[model samples]
Target: MPIPLPSLDDHDFDDLVGEARALLPVLLPEWTDHNPGDPGIVLVELLAWLTEMQLYQVDQLPQSHTLNFLRLLGGPQWSPPDTGGLDAAVRQSVAALHERHRAATADDYEYLVRTTWPEQPQAAGLPRVRRVRCVAGRNLAGTDPAAAAPAHVSVVVLPEPGGTADTHPLPTEALTTALREFLDPRRILTIRHHVVGPEYVDLVVSADLALYEDAVPTDALADARNRLREFYDPFAGGDTRDGWSFGQSVYLSEVYAVLEQSPLVDYIENVRLTRTGTDDGTDADGIALDAHQLVRLTRVDLVGYDSYGRTHPSTWELPA
Candidate 1:
C-alpha cells in the first residue's frame, strides 16, 4: 500500500483569515473594520493566498530535495543491484525507500547478510549463505556439553565449486569476520549469529553389486561411487542440482534408487548403510537431521571386492 499524502497547508483561506481576525483584538483594538470588503480584510486574504502558494511549492519539491536533506543529516544512501540498461540511481532510490535496516526476524537477518555489506570486494570470498535458522534454545554440542546456547541464529553456507577436502571449502576466517562485523550493527543486539557447516554424515557402503558381464567391476564400482558422491554432494546434491535444503533428512530408499538407476549396474544386492561416529551422525537406513542441520557426504568406502569378486571383509562398529 502507498503512503497517504498530507495536505500542504494546515489552514484554508477562510481559516487563515479568521485566525488573522482573531489576533486583531489583541494587536489593534481600535481598528473595527472587520467586514470582508474592507481594505484590511482584503490585505489579509492576499497574504493568506501567498502563504498557501509558498506551502504548496514546498510540498511540490522533488523527492531528490528530500534525499539531499537526508544526506546532509548523515542518512545512508542505497545502491541497487545492477540490472543492465536501467538507471541504477533511480532504482536504488526506489529500493532504498522500501528498505528497513532492522534485523528483528529470521528473513530480515538473512536479507541483511546478503545485501548490507559495506564493501563488495571483501565479500568475494564469503560463502553464499544458503539458509539461516533462528531459535531460542540451548547448545547441543556433545563435545562442549556445558556450552551456553542463547537465542542464536545458525547460518548454513554453500561450499565453493572446487576446493581441497582437508581445509574448509567455504568462506575463510576473514570473510566470516567481515560478515560478523557487517551484521553486528544490523542484527538485534541480543541474538547471537553463528556461521556453521552442515553436519556431515560419512557413508561406508558395503554393497554387493551385480554389474553387466561386459562392464569391468572396478569401473562399475567407480561409477557407483561417483553416483553416490554426486547424490550427497553439499553444493549440488539431492534430486535437483541445487544445494540440499536445511534439515532435509537422508533416506536409505533414495540411496538405493540412485544405485539402481546406474546404467552400468545390473542390480544392487546386500546393501547396508551405517553411520560413522555417534555424534548425531548418519545411522542405519537413514539420517534424521535436526532443523538446523543437514547431511553432507564426507567419505565413500567400497569394501569386499576387487576386479574379480568379493575377496576381503569390512567391519562397522555401531554406537552402544
Candidate 2:
C-alpha cells in the first residue's frame, strides 16, 4: 500500500474567512458592520484566498527541498529527471522517509525483520518469519548466559510453519544469511547484529494430581496436561500472552501453578520436568535457559493419585 501524504494545512477559503470574521468581535469591537458587502469583509475574503493558495503550496514542499531529502538518504537510486518533473523523486524521498531502516533499538530490529522480507521476494521461496525476539548483548552461537557479547544483538527467529521447514520450524540457512545481510546497513556503526534460528529446549512435564470427586478423572487429567503445554507456547505462551521470554528460567512452582489453576484438578503433586532424551528429572527449582533458548514441550504425563497413597493412570503416561 502506498503511504499517505499528511496534509500540511486543512483550512480552506471559507474557513479562513470565518475565522477572521470571528476575530473581529474580539480585536475590533467597534466595527459592527460585518456583512459580506462591507469593504473590510471583501478584504478579509481576498486575504483568505491568498493564504489558502500559500497553504496548498506548503503542502507540496518545494522541489529543491525534496531533492535535498533524497540526497540526505544517501541517494540510493533516485536522480533528477530531465523530461518528467520531480514528482517521482519527491515520491521516492517520502517513501524512504516512511521506511524503517534504523536498528538502534531492539524493537527496530524485530520490526525490520518482519517487514524487510516481504518486500524482496526471493526465488528459492525462503522461509517466512513466524515470530522473532531480539536479545541484546549475547552471541547465540555459543549460547552461554555468563559470556558477555558486547556490541552484539542476537535476533532469535521462528520460521512460519511451511515451505520445507522442520517440524520445529527453524529458519533455513539461506533465510538467516539473507536477513543478516539485509540488516547490516541499517545497524549502528559500532553495533553488530546476528540473525539466528531459535534454540528450543525440549522438555517433558510429568505430574500426578488429585481431582475433585465431581471431576471426571480422564477429562480433568487431560486438561491439566494441556494447560502446562500452552503455558510455554512459543507464540502465545507467556504469562503476558506475548510468547515466552527468552532466557527466562522455568520453575516448578510455575508448572504447579498452571495445573493448579485448572478447575477440575483439586491439587497437584510430584511435578517434574526432564529434558527430552534424558532420564534425570530436574529436581532443581527451575530449568535454566540461555539468552537464546526457549522452552518446547515434548511430552506430558499425568497419573491419578489420592491421599490414601493410591496411584493409577489418569489419561495417559509416557514409557519410563
Candidate 3:
C-alpha cells in the first residue's frame, strides 16, 4: 500500500474562519464583537477564504510533480496503462528501490546477495546461492573471530549443490567477487561489506536405528543415513527443516527427531554427534558451533539397535 501523504494544511474554510473568530478576543481585545454581521468579522472571513484556497493548492500535488518524482527514481518511465495508476506505480517503484537497489542495512546486504546473484556478469556459470547470513560488526574475511570492527559487515553464503560428494558447499572466489561487485554500489558509503564462504564444523555421527515391523534392515539403514544427511544439509536442513540457523548447536535430541520422522525407523538410540578433530563433540550430548559455522556431516555410522541400547552392527550400506 502507498504511504498516505500528510496534509500540508488540514484546515478547511469553516475551520479557518472558526479559528480566526476564536482568536478575536486575544488579538484585538478592544473589538470584542465576533458576530457574523460585524465588519471586522467580515474581513477575517474574507482573509480565511483566501488562506484556505492557498492551502488547498499547496496540499494538492500536480500530475507533473508525480512524473518528476518517478524520473528521479532512475528506472523506466512509469506508464498508467502498465501500472494501472500513478499511485500504484509510485508504490512499486519505491518498493523496488528498497528491495535490492540500496544496501543501507544488514538485511539489505543479505537480501541483495541472493536477489542479485544470478544477474551479475561474473555469475554466468556459478551455482545459485542456496543460503545467506549477514553479521554486522564482524570481519569474517580474516582469522580473528573476536576482533571488534564496528563499521564492517560480513556475509556468509552457501552455494546450491551440483551433485557432488562434498556435502557442504562453499561459495567460490568468483561467487564472492560477483556478490561484492553487486553490493558495493548499493551499500552505504560509510559501511564496509565482506563476502565470504560459510565455515563448516566437520562432524562424525553414529546412531542405532530400530527397524519398524515391515522395515528391511539394509534399506532402513540407508534411509536412516540419508535422513540424517539431509537433516543437517546446508541447503535444506535444521530444526525448522528450512536450513540450519547460523551458530545453531547440534543437540542429540534434534538428531533423534530428524531420524524418527522417517517411517522406516521405529526408534533411535545411542546417538553420538562427535565433532571432527576432537575426542568428543564439545560435550556428550551437544556440538558447539561458532557463529559462522555450519555442520559438515562427513560420516555417519548406522547399525541395528539392541535391546540393551548398545552398539549393534548389521548388514547395512550407504548407496554407492
Candidate 4:
C-alpha cells in the first residue's frame, strides 16, 4: 500500500491564535481584552501570518533540495553505515572508507582472522577463538622480502575449550574453513595459506586431601575440583585468567598451592603430578610445554584402598 504524504504545515494560523490565547491567562492575566478589535489581537494575527509564511516556505522544499544543500557542505550523498545512529554511522563510514581490506603482512593475516570471524554461534557450533599465529613463508633465516616464497604461509589457530571427555581438541573444520574463506579473497595472487591447530600436552593429577575441623569435606572437595579445572581451563585458567599464554609451563607446586587455598584443606599428602601421551607416565615437578603447545588437564582423582583390597573414592580426615 502507498503511504500517505505528510501535511505541509505543522502549525497554522488557528494553532498560533490558540497558543497566544492560552499564554495570555498565564503571562498577562490583567489584559483580558482578546476581541478582534483589540490592538493585542491584531498584533497576534500579524505575527502568526509571518510565522505561517516562513513554515510554508520550509515545507515546500523537496528532499532533493535538502540533499543538494548538504552536498554543498561536502556531506555524503549516499546513506551512511548501518550503525543504527546517523552520527555514528557517518563516522564509521568515513573510517571504513580509509580502511584497508587487503592482507599483506603476517600480522595482517592474524588480525583478519580474529576480527572477521567473531566469536559467535555458527551452523556448526559456537566459534570460540583462542589464539591466532601466522608467518609468511617457511624460511626464517631469509631477510629479503623479495626472496620469500609468494605462495606459502603458515597459520596456526587454537580453538575454544572442550569438555573433559573431548580433551580440548584443535580447531574444528568449520572454523578452519571460515578463516580460509575470509582471507582467501584479500590475499595476494597465488598465495597459499595453511590453517592448523596447536598441539596440546595432556596431564593428570593425584592428591590426598585432609579436611580441618571447621571445614566441610564435600564443600572442600568441590572447591578443590573447581580450582584444578580453572587452573587447566584454556578459556579462563592460569594466573592471568586470560587463558594460559602459549608455551606456558605447568608446575606441580602451583597445583598444590591452589588445593591448599581451600579453608577445609588441612594438608595435602601423596601429592603427585604426571604427564601422559608423550612419554612413560612418571612423577614430575612440572610439565614443559613447547612454543606451539598447551597443557590440558585430563583427570584429577582422589582414592583410597578399602579392606576388600579395592580402590574407592575417599577423603582424608583431620583430628581435633
Q: Per-residue alpha-carbon lDDT of model 3 for 1-320, expressed as tens digits?
A: 65899998789889989988788788888987788899988998899889988998998889888877877775565443364677776777676676557877777777777777677677778878888888889999978855878999998888887677656777778888888887888888999989988888887778878877666666777787788878887767876788877889898888888888878888888888888788767585698877778887778887875445454464322233
Worst 10 residues of 1 by lDDT: 311-320
Clashes of each: 0, 0, 0, 0
- Estimate the TM-score for candidate 1: 0.62
Query: How big is the RMSD of model 3?
Result: 6.3
Question: Model 4, 1-320: lDDT tens per residue?
Answer: 53675777799998998899899989999999999999999999999989998988876756566445544544566654455554555455556655557788887887777765573234246556667777567422245422566567756687765755554668787777777776788888877876767666777778877666665556667678778878787667888887766678888798888888877676777767677665545446677775556777767776433234344364422111
- Candidate 2 lDDT, tens digit per residue, 1-320? 76799997899999999999999999999999999999999999999999999999889867688677777774666676565567766666677687887889898998888777667755148777878888888777565645889998988888776632234567878888988888888999999888888888888788888877777767787788777767887766879876787777888999888988988878888888888766774857878887678888777878866445556574433222
Q: Which stretches of model 4 miss by more than 4 angstroms?
A: 1-90, 97-100, 104-106, 119-152, 158-169, 188-191, 278-285, 303-320
RMSD of each: 7.8, 9.7, 6.3, 12.9
Highest TM-score against the true fold, candidate: 3
Per residue, candidate 1 scores C-alpha lDDT tens digits across 1-320 of 75777776666677788899999999999989999899999999999988877777866757566556545543565333357323454556566667867778767766666566434566765655544444334343334423556676655444453435422244556656766666677777787776544454455555766666577666777788778877766667778966566667777688779888877777766666655575444466677766555565555555434446754333332222
TM-score for each candidate, following the candidate numbering: 0.62, 0.64, 0.71, 0.53
Residue 292, candidate 2: C-alpha displacement in angstroms: 0.5
What stretches of model 1 exceed 4 Å from their correct place? 1-91, 117-150, 158-171, 278-284, 298-320
